[model samples]
Target: VQPSTFITHVAVLTQPSDGTAGRPLPRQPVVAAMDAGGNVMTTYTQPVSVKLNRGDLDSVGMVGTRTVTFRAGVGTFLDLRIDRAGCCLHLVFEVAFGLFRGFSEGFC
Candidate 1:
């Protein structure tokens, strides 16, 4: 991938969900992509394939929607099922357009 054709900035978002009995509170994993100049590209409407691990999974992104498209430069993965407490999320974003293999780590 060219230097100018890669995602320069990757951001992760985590939301704390109220816990219920016998379930891990699911949280949506949100990633933001930006250019080298740090400008968020809202026009990058592309379905980005992402793999998420060791994090919470919001019910919205579950069931065939683990891979999601970016809307307004932010892609929200609703199927993330986080494992364990005090562990950071590991995510890899690939394909779909204008982005290379980018890794983002976040603490929720």
Candidate 2:
């Protein structure tokens, strides 16, 4: 296999699910580096960062390690949480080496 395949973007493998306020997400988020054909680019091992996408200036804060290193092209955010109750919140995953970004499904 040609290690020449480049990472074109990031993808959310698992979407976060609703959970109690101040508690970890019932389903943690998972992200992956992807090739142009949407295949996991396992050769692309780099740190991916996640952040809360707060559309408005609310006091909502995300609690967890903001960055995770890719393993076999995937990164799982195990301890992600919301500091307060909210609806329609989303998480954005990014990699600094490129213009890649992935958005998670809306969750409470």
Candidate 3:
């Protein structure tokens, strides 16, 4: 089935919080599929992947399970962390198929 027919986009339900370099954010990010009306599309289950929106040029990049298959339309990133020190960083979450996408708030 075509995903666009079911989910309009994805949203960051739980935003990542600032944390020490190389340590996982105390509040992990959680993404979910959403319909056009801003409701969770519980039936849409697919893989969701995350990456740093931007960071220091010399940073080691994001660590941990960067991609996860959704359960009941929700993707929970349990251990996401940046390897280098930075401020006001944002994480971008996108569907594995490269369709829907979402962004987390700034963090360090």
Model 1 scores a C-alpha lDDT of: 0.55
Q: Pick the candidate with the highest TM-score.
A: 2
For residues 1-108, write the lDDT of model 3, one tens digit per residue. 334447878899998988888898899999998887777877877889998875534464789999998888899999988888888788888885667789888877
Winner on TM-score (1 vs 3): 3
Distance from true position, residue 81, model 2, in Å? 0.4
Q: Write down the lDDT of every candidate, Cα atoms only.
A: 0.55, 0.87, 0.83
Compared with the true structure, the alpha-carbon lDDT of candidate 3 equals 0.83
The collision pairs in model 2 are none
Q: Return the TM-score for each candidate structure.
A: 0.54, 0.91, 0.88
- Model 2, residue 49: C-alpha shift (Å): 0.5
lDDT of 1 by residue, 31-69 (tens): 666678666666677666665542544322212355788
lDDT digits (tens) for residues 1-108 of candidate 2: 444378888899899999998899999999999887878988777899998885833788999888999999999899989999888998889997547899998888
Q: Rank the candidates by TM-score, best first.
A: 2, 3, 1
Candidate 3 backbone overlaps, count: 0
